[model samples]
Target: MSHDAIVLCRLDELVEGQALGFDPLGTGKDSVFALRHGGEVRVYRNSCPHLEVRLEYRKDRFLSVDGSQIICYAHGARFLPDSGLCVYGPCLGQSLSALRWHAEADWLVLEAGQLEACAP
Candidate 1:
């Protein structure tokens, strides 16, 4: 992967409508989630908007039933695929903070200046 690009798992490793957390670029508790929906991939901070904590059922597991929505294991909040908008729970109309990335040469490259501080 390029220095500016995120290390996207191989297509064989990620099924549709699933999300996996990526380690922080450096060393920290902070991390990002790479979500796959159809043929598109969206990246966001791994924290749930409702509680600002990591959301996963297990290691790198962050998908809701039917594998169509992102679910917060902390409080069961649901977010829409692709948009990252909260569709239920206390988050209401809020959205997950996104990081911009592009697929190049079969890798997901995190765009320059696109990383942002996530809500805490």
Candidate 2:
């Protein structure tokens, strides 16, 4: 079966150590966010394991002030940007669900099958 790539953003559009949120599947729920850190881009489901709450306190605000980690403002959980490993907070040792994605030319595309897997 063939699937279409869900474009998230252009490589030049996203700044390093920052993040952008999107609802690529049009699920009506903003459950995905892409983080660019250490010269790499990583996408993850936005739900926090602690309470399954959305990670950002504000829209598209997923990273900590210093941009060293992904922070769950709901409970102050801190996760490694590259690995999504929760290093601190109530849900220690847990991780955000990483989604499959790739950079093609200058666009970041989320794997269509992976996006379907995240469907409700």
Candidate 3:
């Protein structure tokens, strides 16, 4: 697998502002969150800086009230959509770690390190 582009998910699977987690290429842990905002597809490491844990109420579901911000189910923290900055919560001004990814053709190109790490 190439670190430059490793398929993670389908384009149709990730809608605008919707986020999902995938195994990064080198660890058993996985990151989530993909915001389809500002006419762009942005992804981030699915972890709260404050707690170092995943942020989601359900599998593959990361949303705040009205889907406006990324909320952490662990502590009710909220993050801005565009910048992934912590808008309201313990880690104010902090942001989730982002990863380079995109959907090209029918493949979800992701970093190889991301997948190899999280592969079970």
Best by the lDDT measure: 2
- For residue 105, give model 2's deviation from the true position in Å: 2.5
Q: Write the per-residue lDDT of candidate 3 for residues 7-100, one digit (tens) a residue.
A: 7777667676567766545355455556676566777777788878788877767776566788888987898877789988899889977766
Q: What TM-score number comes out for model 2?
A: 0.90
Clash number by candidate, in order: 3, 0, 16
What are the per-residue Cα lDDT tens digits for candidate 2 across 1-120? 126778888878778878988888788777799978998889999889897888888888999888999999999999999899999999999999999887788888887876765565
Give the RMSD in angstroms, all C-alphas superposed, for model 1. 2.6
- Best of the candidates, TM-score: 2
Ranking by TM-score: 2, 1, 3
Poorly placed runs, candidate 2 (over 4 Å) = none
CA shift at 35, candidate 2, in angstroms?
A: 1.2
Write the residue-wise lDDT of candidate 1 on 24-72 in tens digits. Answer: 5564544677877977778888888886888787877888768888888
Query: Against the unseen true structure, what C-alpha lDDT does each candidate score?
Result: 0.74, 0.86, 0.70
Q: Scored by Cα lDDT, where does model 3 land?
A: 0.70
Query: What ranking emerges by lDDT with the best candidate at the front?
Result: 2, 1, 3
